[model samples]
Target: MELGLVGRTNAGKTALFNLITGSTAEVAPYPFTTREALRGRAEVPDPRIDAIADIQDIPRRVRAQVQVVDIPGLAAGAGQGEGLGGKALGELRQMDALIHVVRSFANNEVAHPEDAINPLGDAEAIDIELLLADREQIERRLEKVRKSAKSGDATAKGEQGLLELLVTEIDQGNPLRIVGDAEALALGIGMGLLTAKPVLYVINSDDPGEPLPELVAYATSRDAHVSQLAVGTELELAQLSPEDAAELAQEMELGDVRGADAMVRAAYELLDLVTFFTGSGPPEARAWPIQRGLSADKAAGKIHSDMERGFIRAEVVAWDALVAAGSFSKARESAQVRMEGKDYIVQEGDVMQIRFAV
Candidate 1:
């Protein structure tokens, strides 16, 4: 999963990205500090994978990963290419989901682009810019579809109706995603409409452990999830070992969890992705991310193309069952394994041992 980090200038986005990926990207107290996207791989944390590895005495353990991209800041009039937001917005179109960073902490040295500390207003402004950009893009495409329809193109003519309806919704201040039917939703995805991506708000807090009631309320109203992270504290935590960090966290009275973990975990869940595993005795134990309703054949394709192409069957067992029985042979001995075919739907926490032909 590619998660695009976006927000206004000086929103501490780079700081959060650095903390999560342990990358030393240049972070300055200025707008548009990130002109291009800086990407780093984040190994997603999962306890179940650890259990599987320990129980199986696996030689190696590989966790799921997400590609984190820090996008440039957006500004007012960005939809019309203001402050190079248009260019940055283009990068965002490729992201699987969006992490919107909102600056709420007041730092004397770090000046706000808007000269104030209103996170709600900043979030709303970015939302409108994305909405306007989508509208502009769809309107331009709709014109071409119309021209093609006039040329007696049947496919173009059929698409023209849907395009017209989308434009009307966009002009009425509704995003193509929200106002769209299943077809429109698919169309909007093809068009790379900015508003179509799922969003998770990250509020850079003034202090630790505070959820910022007002910001939480705002995100709640929009049916979005919010993570209150103390960027400074998280940066500190990132510099220490896990054991040391836990000790310091206790002494400093940080929140119930580390900010860095909370931010990434929240973003992961926001994308509605599920985790499954592959179990064999020696080579490795790994976790794979898939959509909720993925089928066995399709899920096999995620591991390798040959697995999908030569798919014979799958031996599926719950991760816990495998762990409790201590091995695949033990699970089979206990009748805990389910034999599923290509059409079978894969479930979360499933430990799969695939059978295939050469």
Candidate 2:
């Protein structure tokens, strides 16, 4: 899965991106610090991987990773092709979801483009830009579809009707997400509408304990998730050793859990993904993330095309059950493992061993 980080200038997007991906991306106090989009992968932390690896004595353990992209700060009029707006918004269209980094921290050194600290207003500004961009994209598509509809194309006529309704909705200051028709929403997503993608609002605040009711309500209204992070503090903690960071975090009254981890997990939930494991023993144990209702063969395809092609059946067991049994053979002997056909819907925490023929 891929997540794109977007928000107004100097919202600490690069700082959060660096902390999550362990990248050395330059973070400055000024706007447009990130000139272009930077891509990196973040390992999704799961205790089950460690449990399975320890129990199986696996030599190499690979955790599931989510792709993250840090796009440059979105200035006002970006949808109108303002500075870096065209390129940045274009980059966001390719992401699986969006992480809107809203600035709530009052830093004297860091400059807010608007010269004021209003989280709700800042979020609304960026959101409007996205809406504008989506509106323009839809209009351009509607032009072509209208031409086809005039030629008596039934599918084009239907699509034209949907686009017209959506255009009206966008004009009324509503996102495409509010549209109830599954077909219309699917069409919007297929067209890469910016507002159609899932979004998580990450509030970059110094006093994360203090709740911003306005922003929270806004997110709730939009059907999006909200997470607060002390980006500056987290970046400082990131510079320290794990032990030292843990001590500092405890001292600061923050729990040992990293904010980035919590946020990434939240992003995973936003995408409605489930994780499955792939190692019983040997050189490697790995975790894979897939959509919630992915079937056995499709999950196999996530691992390897060859596995999906030759898929016969999957030997599956819960991660905890496998750990309790200590080995795959032991789990099988105890009847904790089950044979699932290709159409079997894989479950979360499922440890699957694809039994296939070349």
Candidate 3:
């Protein structure tokens, strides 16, 4: 899954990116410090994979990984080519989900672009910018589609109708995500509209100990999730060793190292993704990501096309069952191991071994 860290200038976007991905991208208290999208991988924690590996006496080498992209901050006229606005907004469109970092922190040395610290207002402004960008994209596409429809193209005519519907929805202050699934998918892929992707608002505050009610309500009203984090503190924590970071966190009574994990997990949820495991022996046990309800065959395809081509039944056992039985053979004997067909829906925490015939 790919997640984009986005917000306005001086919203602690880069700092949050550094905290989550351990990236050293240049961070400043100003706009456009990050001109290009910074890419990094974050290891997702899955204790179930570890448990399965231990039961099978396998060395655990791999954990699940999520790709994170930190795009440059967007501005008021981002879609129309403002300071890094067009480029950043374009990059943001490709992300599977967005982590919108709203500044709730106050520091005189580093000024907000709007010259005040109101996370709710910042979120609303960002949402409006995204909405406007989508509106423009839809309007332009509708014109092209209309032209194509005039040529008697059935597909273009159909898509044009959908775009028109979408435009009406957007104009009514509704995002494309709330549109019909067919129209949503059509618009989502064709337009790459930023608001089409799921978004979680991250409230960045100076005071690590308190929750911001305004930020929470703003996100809630939009049906989005909100997470509170002190970006500066998280950046400081990111620089320390895990042990030292834990010590510092305990000392500060910050309670949980600033929600980096929660942020990633929420991103996963927003994308409707889940993790499944392959391999049972040490270091060989690895977790792979799949959208919810993905079939066994599709999961195999994620591993390799050849695996899908060979397409045999999968030996499936729940993680907890494997741990209880202590081994694959024991699990089989206990009837905990079941052979699943290619079409079987892969579940989270499922340990699968594919059998294929060449």
Best by lDDT: 2
Q: Rank the candidates by lDDT, best first.
A: 2, 1, 3
- What tens-digit string does per-residue lDDT give for candidate 3 at 1-358? 6889888888988887777777788988656688788998877766677777776778755877788898887788875666678788888888888889888888888877888877778887888888888888888888888998999999999888787787787788776766666755566656678777788888888676545776676676566788877789878887899999999989888876456776667766777786888865554888888988999988988998888989889999888888898988888899998999999999988988898876
Off by over 4 Å in 1: 150-158, 221-223, 280-283, 291-294
Q: Alpha-carbon error at 96 in model 3, in Å?
A: 1.7
Task: Score candidate 2 by TM-score against the native.
Answer: 0.93
What lDDT score goes with residue 43 in model 2? 80
Order of the predicted models by TM-score, top scorer first: 2, 3, 1
Clash count list over all predictions: 0, 0, 6
**Error at 16, model 2, angstroms:** 0.9
> Which pairs of residues clash in candidate 2, taking residues 3 or more apart in a chain or in different chains?
none
Choose 2 or 3, whichever is better by lDDT: 2
lDDT (Cα atoms) of all candidates against the true structure = 0.85, 0.90, 0.80
lDDT of 3: 0.80
Candidate 1 C-alpha lDDT tens digits along 151-261 = 999999988887777777767766554654788778887888887777888998868666778878877655577888899777877789888988888888884577777
**Number of the predicted model whose TM-score against the real structure is largest:** 2
Worst 10 residues of 2 by lDDT: 206-215
